[model samples]
Target: MKPVTFRNRTWDVAANLHLPADFDPAQTYAALVCVHPGSSCKGQTAGIYAERLAAEGFVAIAFDASFQGESGGEPRYVEDPATRVEDVRCAVDYLMTLPYVDEARIGVLGVCAGGGYAVNAAMTEHRIRAVGTVVAANIGRLYRSYGAAAMLDNIGKQRTAEARGATPLITTWIPDSVEDRKAAGVEDVDLVEAVDYYRTPRGRNPCAPNRLRFTSLANVLAFDAFHLVEDLLVQPIQIVTGDVPGAFGSMQEGRDLYDRVKGEKDLFVIPGATHYDLYDRPEPVARAVGRLATFYRKHL
Candidate 1:
C-alpha cells in the first residue's frame, strides 16, 4: 500500500494505491477504482477491498471523495450526488495516467452508497469495462423514504436560511448509539452493525467522521443512479448483496438494478449476511472479494 494524491477538477483527492506482492512496474496490469460509502472514508471498507483485489493481481485504488476525509473541498462533509459520481470518473482519469495501468481494462467497485455512484459513473464513462457493487443503496430512494412533502418543506427552509448566510446544518447518518437506534425504531441487526463499524474500533478510522451537510439532501433526493441504466449501462455488471433482511433494502435494490441493465450481469447473494455485515466481516468480505476478482478477471 502506498499513499497517492491526484486532482479531481479543483480538489486534491487522497487515496491509497495497492499493488500485488509480486507486482512489476515494467508490466501493465488491470486496475480497479474502489469508491467508499456515504459518511465513510477511503481507509475503511473500500481500502480493505482494494487491498484484497490487489492481492488478486490487480492494481487497485481506494480514494476519499473530494469534500470529505483528507481530500480538498469547501463546505466540508457535503454529500452531493453529482460530486460522488464525478469522483469515480476522476479516479478513472487518474488510473489512465499511470504507465503501469491498462487503460482499456479499468473496473470500478462501490460499496453501499458508493455502489450507486459506481453505477452512475459507469453509465457515461465507457472506460469502465466492468462494474461491481456490494450492498448497493440508491441515495435518491433512501432520501425519498423520508417522505417528499416533509423533505421538500425542510429543503425550502434550509435553502432560505442558506440564502441568509446561515451555516450548513449537519447530521449523522447513523444513530449516536444502539439505544438511540432503538428509540428511533431502527434497532435492527443491520443498523447495529453499521453503527459499530463506523463508530467503534472494529472498523473506525480517523478520517471517517460520519457526518454530512443536511442541505445536501436536496441534491441526493433528485439524483438517481439508475436514471437511464437500461439504456446507458451496457458494460458487464456484478452485484453482491446479503440475503438477510436489513437496513437499506439491498436485496431488492440489487435485483432492481440487475433487472434494468441489458448487459451481462450477475447478482451474488451471501446467504446469511446483512447489509452491514459485508462491510468488514471476514468471511463474507472474503467471499465478495473472490466473486469480484473472478468477474473482473473475465471481463476486464
Candidate 2:
C-alpha cells in the first residue's frame, strides 16, 4: 500500500493506494475506491478491504474524508452528507489521473455510513461502473431514529452559540468505554460491537478519533443518502449486510436499498454476522471480499 494525497475541493484528502503484487505500470487495471465508515478512517476497515481487493488483482484506494482523519478541513470532524458524497466523486477524479488505471472500469465500495454516501454519489456520478456496500447505514435515517425534531432544535442552538464565538460542541459517535455504555443503559448489539471494533485495539486508529461536531447534525438530519436511489442508481450494485438485527438498522436499510434499486443488484447476508462483524472479522470479511471480487470482475 502506498500513501497518497489528492485534492478534494480545498482540502487535501489522504489515502492509501493498494496494488496487486504483480502490478505492472504498463497494464491498465480496474480500480475501486474503498470508503471508510463514518467516524472511521482509511487505516481501518476500508484499508483492509482495499488491501484484500488488491490481492485479488484490482487497484483499490482507501481514503480519509475531508475534515476527518489526516485530511485537511476546518471545524474538524463534521459529518456533512453532501461533502461525504462529493468525496467519493473526488476520489474518482484522482484515480483517473493514474496512467495505469482504467477510467472506464472504476468502481466503489463503502462500509457502514460510507456505504450510504457511496450509493448517493454513484446515483449521479456515472463514471462509477459498479457499487458495493458492506453493513451500510443511512446516516439520515439513523439520526431520525433518535427523533429529528428535538435534535434539530438542539443543533440550532449549538450552531447559534458557535457563530457567536463559542467553541464547537463536540460529541462522540459512541461512549468512551463499555462501562460508560452500560452506565447509560445502552444494550444495543450493534452499538456494543461498534465499541468493541472502533474503541478497542481490534480496529482503533488515532486518525479515526470517533468524535463529531454536534452542530453538524443539521445537515445530517436533513440529508437523505438513499433519496431518489430508485430513479438515479442505475449502476449494478451489490449490497452486503449481516442477518443479525441491531439498533443501527443497517440490516433493514440494506434490504430497503436492495428492494428499491431497479438495476442489476444482489444481496448477501452473512448468517451469524452482526453489523460490526463484517467490519474486520477474518472469516466474514474474507467471504465479503471474495463476493465483491466476483461482482467487480463481472461489472467493472
Candidate 3:
C-alpha cells in the first residue's frame, strides 16, 4: 500500500493506494475507491477492504474524507453529506489520471455511512461503472431515527451561537467505551459493536478521532443519500449487510435501497452478522469481499 494525496475542491485528501503483488505499471487494471465509515478513517475498515481487493487483482484506494483524518479542511471534523459525496467524485477524478488505471472500469465500495455516500455519488457520477456497499447506513435516515426534530432544533441553536463567536461544539460519534454505554442504559447491539470497533484498539486509528462538529447535524439531517436513486442510479449495485437488527437500521436500509434501485442489483445478507461485524471481523468481511470481487469483476 502506497500513501497518496489528491485534491478534492480546496482540500487535500490523504489516501492509501493498494496494488496487487504482481502489479505491473504497463498493464491497466480495474480500480475501486473504498470509502470509510462516518467518524472513521481510511486506515481502518476501508484500508482492509482495499488491501483485500488489491490481492484480488484490482487497484483499490482507501481515502480519508476532507475535514477528517489526515485530509485538509477547515472547521475540522464536520460530517457534511454533500462534501462526503464530492470526495468520492474527486477520488474518481484522481483515478482517471493514473496511467495504470482503466477509467472505464472504476468502481466504488463504501462501508457504514460511506456506503450511503457511495450510492449517492454513483447516482449522477456516471464515471463509476459499479457500486458496492457493506453494512450501508444512510446518515440522514439514521439520524432521523434518533429524533430529527429535536436534533434540528439543537443544531439551529448551536449554529446561531457559533455565528456569534462561540466556540464550535464538538461531539463524539459514540460513547467513550462500551462500559460507558452500558452504564448509560444504551445497550443496542449494533451501537455496542460500533463502540468496540471504533473506540478501542480492536480497530482504532490515530487519524480517526470519532468526533464531529455538532452543528454539522444541520446538513446531515436534511441530506437524503437515497433520494432519486430509483431514477438517477442506473449503475449495477451490489449491497451486502448483516442480518442482525439494531438501532442503526442499516439492515433495513439496505433492503429499502435494494427495493428502490431500478437497475440491476443484488443484496446479500450475511447470516448471524451484525452491522459492525462487517467492519473488520474476518469471517463476515471475507464473505462481503468475496461477493464484491465477483460483482465488480462482472460489471467493471
Off by over 4 Å in 1: 182-185
Sort by TM-score, best first: 2, 3, 1
lDDT of 3 by residue, 177-253 (tens): 87888898878898888889988899989899878899888899999999999999999999999999998898999
Which digits, one per residue and each the tens of the lDDT, describe model 1 over residues 112-163?
9999999999989999999999999898898788786698889889989989
How far out, in Å, is residue 122 in model 1? 0.4
In candidate 2, which residue pairs clash? none
Pairwise lDDT winner, candidates 1 and 2: 2
User: Candidate 3 has which clashing residue pairs, if any?
Assistant: none
Worst 10 residues of 1 by lDDT: 173-182
Rate residue 274 of model 1 by lDDT.
88
Q: Give the C-alpha lDDT of model 3.
A: 0.93
82: Cα error in model 1, Å: 0.8
Per-residue accuracy of model 2 over 1-300 as CA lDDT, tens digit each: 899998988879999999999999999999999998889999999999999999999999999998999999887999988888889999999999999999999999999999999999999999999999999999898999899999999988888888899988889999877788889988889999888888888898999888998988889998888999989999999999999999889899999999999999999998999988898899999999999999999999
Against the reference, the lDDT scores of all candidates come to 0.90, 0.93, 0.93
